[model samples]
Target: MMGQLYSVGRNIEAKVMKFVSKALIVSLMGASLLAGAAHAATTDKKIALSNNYAGNSWRQAMLKSFESVGKKAVADKVVAKVDVFTTADRAVPTQAAQIQNLILQRYNAIVLNASSPSALNGAVRQACSAGIIVVSFDSIVTEPCAWRITVDYNAMGRQQVAELARLQPKGGNLLEIRGLAGTSTDAKIHGGITEGLKNYPQFKVVRSVTGDWDQTTAQKNISAVLPSLPPIVGVVSQGGDGYGAAQAFAAARKPRPTIMLGNRQDELAWWQQQKQDGYRTWSASISPGISSFAFWVAQQILDGKPVPKDITIPYLAFTQENFEAELKAIPKGGVASKDYTQAGAIAIITKK
Candidate 1:
């Protein structure tokens, strides 16, 4: 009887041991699955970007270029994602709000082309604190970001003014049309022009106003100044506004100003017009295309490549000597033809 009872006890103990071992195995497998999921989550990343405005041609070009090139580069990659936002008009606060929302969503990175530098300071600070890598382009933000990609605005400005001064060696009045209000690039370019003007004391900036970098706005502004215009020997305006200013001069039936300082595209067209009509108002200009360089900068950082704290791409100044050559060689618009929002996704998916 004692032996039988002992056998029964041993059988019960064996069953209990088997149950405990199976539970342990199940628990281990569950934990392993959870760990794998966490690992997968860590491998992929999110990027967010915002532009202050897309109202003008230049801004549109920028949007298109970034989307096109970035998409092509990352079509094969699987671990990356990009989110983009834009303020249709140059709305500073709206852009800031967009950045704040992106931070709340816990995006991994942000690219900012602020309409106004100082306006986005608070949002930029918040994003940096959240460990998001911030890349600034075109118009730089006031606060320090991870990287800034821009042209030499001041130099470009100075060069434009200097070119105009050369065109009017006798020291004529310079009618200056400015860019968007409160933008760093505007300040830099205008500042450079001021610096350049300092070199030529004879050149007087008789009238200056903000064209707001809009064609219609510039046309209106320039038209207002037309009554006092025949004295204006040269017109210095932002690229977009240059053609408008010229129109104002043309409408008055005055000899086109001796020299016009503006953007590359307008300068080329003006130079060609000058050749045909013997119009003297069109002179030299400096190229300040912001979109292509912006993409190049974003690509560098995304690829884990080192970039300068602030990268300044060289500008092309179109003068009579090389005007035709430069115009012919002007590279077709970079990535401006494609969809930009979808392009951001490609940036991350690229293997290298």
Candidate 2:
């Protein structure tokens, strides 16, 4: 009787162990399926860039960064295809039509560097309604449907003045070099610069010129105005205009002033030369590489990730003490930049 009862108990134990093993296997399979869902393949997605303008070195660099990442994404089979299209002009109508065409092309996503903050809302909404993801960076749009990637440009402008106050403790007249006309970026930075003046009363902006964020244009405009302006002690410029401002000051035979610089290769090269002369200044600007970051954001969104609507990146800043390394990091003709990968994008999204 004891032997029969023991044998029956052993059989029951064996059956319980087999059942647990099957349950364990089932649980693991479910977990694996969840993980797979989280990283849904983006291999079939098509993405395109809709750039507002390509006239300046900054925009050119922005496009180059986008292409560098985009091509690699294609080659690695991370995305099916990536394309770029630049509007001939910075007209809202032109870009709107361009986006409408992209929509008709059946692209899964559209990356935009918009011309206006609000004017592009109609087009952006149309894209969203068509189930196309619109990711706008740098010159971003104001539409709720679009994902925005940018730096605190207003803070950058304010910081420029703060840096000026540090380098030139005894402030004097300032020549303001502005950016492209009728854009939100120009207005935000300008507003910050104006607000900064209130904090540092010693600096006075006696002259202002629209540099149009182009070196040649900046030089011409600054030269045109230099003859009539007073003895300026500094030039507060939007990026891409600093090196030009320096040239204008030299060409006009005026005394050199402390000029805040952008992170262009030429700007850093000139800064390096000026550093030898004990010319102390700082450089800061939004990285053109934000294009690549934007690409990843768009991709992650398509991957079914929950990304924030507005993402702000830190500005690329350079100073007299620590700019040479970054200057060398950038290719001779390129801007200082950093690209993003899928992992990098995931890290950012996870944190958010």
Candidate 3:
């Protein structure tokens, strides 16, 4: 009886040891999985924004929008950091050197507002060869491998000219305010304006000036030229200078001609004030929030998602009927009626 009892105790001890071993193995596996998940959640991604110029209010607003979006990305662990670089002189060589620096830093992606369409092509290709994603918006690059985000600037130009033609059916002298001198966007818009005016032979562009897309510059230049030119019947202008042009004509005490407006809060406010005097006009612009859109695209690519090489965003147009409401919705000094969102930017990607 004593021997049997001893044997039973030994058997119980063996069973207890086996159960504890299995539990220890299970606990170790669970701890390993938890560690792997934590590592994945903390993985870091770095992005850079390369802007060729930030000389005007429009560009300032654009940079702010990008920073806003990038801040949220960092908080959510979507990106570890976002670095911004700008060239005030708008030189192509300077911009190319910036791209090389970004590559050396091993940035996962770059969002570029190119200085020239073709000048940045080689630098863009070099970055791509080094396995970095390049996304361009606003003033874009022409490199085939880099993704592009843009509105149809040519169409915007044509639409403005068509509106001018409508206001002056009999045809008259047009004061044309062009953007920066050598940008691809400037050339495209000028081409469209030329084509649009072909149908209206009676209308002629008497004087053309470069506003450089700034309010003060537009006012100064237009004010100086008004004293020398003939009676202007209409005005066709690019963004950022419509309000200044109106102010110039107001200061001169000349009859305000039919002017096509751009998307600026001050311009819209001026229109509101003029509405009391029975003044009316149409406004359109390429949304300055496009930098935020490009930032979103870079985030998507970093996450290993598929996206289109060419993404085109449309310009926002506001008529007399809705300009007041649109203006009311935006914040003080805001460029657009709507703010950009990650989902909205993602929707721009074209599915294969």
Candidate 4:
């Protein structure tokens, strides 16, 4: 009777072990499937890039970066479709209409470079209501429902003033070269510069010119106004205007001021040449590849990943020490940029 009891106990233990091993295998398989679902969630999604403007070199570079990334993701079956639409004019209404069209087309996601911060809120709201993801970069929208990849334009402006103070202790008259007049980027930077000037009262902005963020436009505007303005000790510009500002000063036959640069290849090359003549200044710009970053952010959202509504992208700055090396890395006729990979975008989103 004791031997019978012992045999029964051994049989029970073996059956329990077998059950536990099967349960463990099933649990592992379920976990693997969950992981796969996270990555494959967006494979059937269609994404669109709703660009408001592409008139400048930076804009062109941005489009190219998005194209490269978008094409690869489509080919790899990461997303079902990727399409681009740029308004011929940088008008809020045009973009609004475009957004409406995109909604009608039933795009799963829309990556945006908005024409205005607040003007497009209605369209953006409509998109959100339809269950589409909206991610804006560069010139971003102000709508609460949209995700923004923003730059600290205010901080950038303030830093420019601080850097100028260091470069020129005895501050004099300054010429402020602005970007596209109606953009949030323009407004924020101008506001920051105005605010920053409160601390550095010795520096006075004597005149302001709209460059439209283009070389020829900047040169034309600066040249037309240079004769009327006071002697500028420094020219603070909103990128893409630096090299053109230099040209305007040269044309006017005036003494060259310490002009702050944007990270265009031509601007960097011009700065490199001037460094030989004892000229000194710094360069900074938003990476054009931010379009690609925005693309991935949109994709990740479709993957059901949690992301912040407001995400700030770092502005790339080049000092006198680093400009030469950076210049070598940038392609001619393009702005400084670095494209994003899937892993890279995930890392950025995770960190944020």
- Which is better, 3 or 4, measured by lDDT? 4
Estimated TM-score for each candidate: 0.70, 0.83, 0.79, 0.83
lDDT value, candidate 3, whole model: 0.79
Worst 10 residues of 3 by lDDT: 33-42
C-alpha local distance difference test of each model: 0.62, 0.83, 0.79, 0.85
Q: Candidate 4 on 180-254: residue-level lDDT in tens?
A: 877778888888788888999999998999997788999999999999988899988888889899999999999
Q: 1-352 in candidate 1: lDDT tens per residue?
A: 2212222233444344543453455456774333222212122555656887776556666665655544543342312565557888678778888999998988776777877767788888999898877778777776876567666677777777777766678887878888877667678778988899999998888888788766678878888877875487887765667777777778777667754534445545666667776544333232333444454445445434445666665554555665666556444421112222323422422323
Best by lDDT: 4
Model 3 spans > 4 angstroms off: 1-43, 165-171, 199-202, 329-334
Stretches of candidate 4 off by over 4 Å are: 1-38
After superposition, candidate 2 runs with Cα above 4 Å error: 1-38, 331-333, 346-352
Give candidate 2's error at residue 338 in angstroms.
Answer: 2.3
Candidate rank order under lDDT: 4, 2, 3, 1
Query: Candidate 3, residue 236: CA error in Å?
Result: 0.7
Model 2: per-residue lDDT, tens digit, 257-295? 998888888889998998887989989888888899899
Return the lDDT, model 4, position 233. Answer: 95
